[model samples]
Target: MSAALMALTGHAEDRTAAAREWRAAAKPVVGYVGADVPVELLTAAGVLPLRLAGSPRADDGAGERYLGRGLDPAVRSILSRLLAGDYGQLDGLVVSRDCEASLRLFYAVRELRRIEPATALPPVQLVDVLHLPHHTTTRYVLAKVRQLRATLEGWVGHAIADADLTRAVVAHDRLRDLLTEVARLRRRQPARLTGTQALSVVAATTALPVERATELLQRLLAEAGSLPEAEGHRVFLTGSSHDSPDVYAALEAAGLLIVGEDHDWGDLLFHRRVGGSTELALAERYQHNGPSAARASIRRRAAHTAEAASACGARALLCYARRHDDGPPWDFPAQRAATGLPAVSLERQPYGALDIDARAVAARLRVTEEVAR
Candidate 1:
């Protein structure tokens, strides 16, 4: 692997170091939980926006006492980190109602703030954006976007002018377009990029600033292009948002190439630009954002999966979900019917424990691939 690829895989270390330097320089930093929170808004407010991930090594004991055991491990881990002062440098945090866990997290953080004032997390704000496309919902979502933009501006103590927002939008759109190019490489036959590589790039982008992320990705694209294509059964993955590349690594080990996916952390995040004033464009983009199993109707979710699978020319589809995450399973039946293709459902996984059953999943994938052939 190239240095860029290595850096992409070891992004957590890179992010940690970069954040420390950013803080030493007194740069305002904002943390966000979901992909739905627009980076452009934060950029316009003159703050670095860091996407928070659940730590594989974090103990949920501190968090479980407040959120109970029903919350997703990822959520619990984030809460534990917050209580432990792991993200103490953040100027503020924006949590969205992207799923039940996210909504619960907003309340849980609020309660934590009420009870523990000293360890107070940076002011938390909820960015409520519904996926519904009705006019009423559209107006509501636009209003929310405007509200968030104002909130971020106030938090950063910067009056984000129109020019600042326009520049930020351009930067964000460039990042999205570059990622789209990388996705195309992943879709190539004898795939130019592995699932693990694709995922590493995605994870790294979420952590790094837009300009730096785009630069690294450009270098990565060049190196990946010259490499020989890989041979494997092309598979489409649908499941809860993956915070790590464990599942992708496991699938690749099983002789499957995850050419595409319909997850928040994947293709669903790559979308076209909205044309208009910065605020209006942000709202319009948010209103038409792609559907996720957690929030979209089952029919829409199934349609999205089938379309994504077909677009990538995948031989089979794999539905992988964690034990506590039930959203994917709820949408699987409809997706199976919609595709009418060879499909395999992996057993419920322990949160962040993809290695434990990787061999079993690979074996099942082989059977599914053979059936498809």
Candidate 2:
């Protein structure tokens, strides 16, 4: 692969670099708080979809002061960065509820707007999407989706034509298809790439324009295809949306290749595609896909994770929970019992270096190593 292609897959590793690249494109970027925001809709509306993952090196002091320290560290970091003008150039921001911290982030940002408009927060919108697949849920979320579309239309001062949405869906669906191929490689007996590398690709795509991301992914897939297969204790990671590759890097360093993860930031986000190329079809498909942590029962969540682990040939399961991220703990017991795999769970501070938790890493390494023995 050429140097540019290599950089495309690894470039989002640095938040500053990613932001600079996006800004250089000079598009009207719409920052999102979580993975649930529909990139298709944003793209159709001529806005670049940017997920607001705070810089890995950011301190949570400003975020804690505004939103309280009780929030997840990653969430706090997002708040800190937004308040400090890290994403000041965004044309708008959309916050949705895939988790509690995201919802809280939305509210905090709204309050911040009222308290001080000079910080250049851009326009912010809250997308209240219902997570379950019930009839009422679909209807409610679809309406919200339309409302969100209308909100964006007003901002852009033009109607998003059906053709535009169709094109957007096709583009996003193609991107998802390529990512699925990457996931297939990750699931191989000896993984085709490290979990950190796989995730870096995912993270990079989220920050780039759809066409650019797709082009980069195609090159990445080609590059990974030529590499020798990896060798390690194959593991399935669960819990927490990892914005940085540190956790995956740490796990891989411990002789575990993360073959799969049940986090939204990983397999969950890329596993599914929009069923149809229309707005209504896209809305329905997304709402009914499966319940995220905020919407599903422990049993449902556990079942999903266990099945994914089994499908990926993971010999063990590991979960790393950040402080105040409560959903994972609730699902752990059932997930462990259901999977019947060697398991390790650990606690870490938000955005803290995952590899630095010596005890947790040691315990996880021990489990994988023992299993291999």
Each candidate: RMSD to true structure? 1.9, 2.4
Cα lDDT over the full model 1: 0.80
Name the TM-score of candidate 1. 0.94
Write model 2 residue lDDT over 1-373, tens digit each, in one string: 4443467556676544655666687756788877678778999998878777866686779888988877788888888888777765777888887778889888888887888878667788887777675788878878878888998998878999989999999999899999898888888876777788778778878887889888877877767757667777788888777888777777677677889898777888877788787667777766765546656789998999889999999888887887788888788888888998878777554564664654456466566658757
CA displacement after TM-score superposition, residue 180 of candidate 2 (Å) = 0.5
In model 1, pairs of residues that clash are none
**Predicted structure with the largest lDDT when compared to the true one:** 1
**Residue pairs with backbone overlap in model 2:** none
Q: Tell me the spans in candidate 2 whose CA falls farther than 4 Å from its real position.
A: 1-5, 15-26, 348-350, 355-373
* TM-score, candidate number 2: 0.93
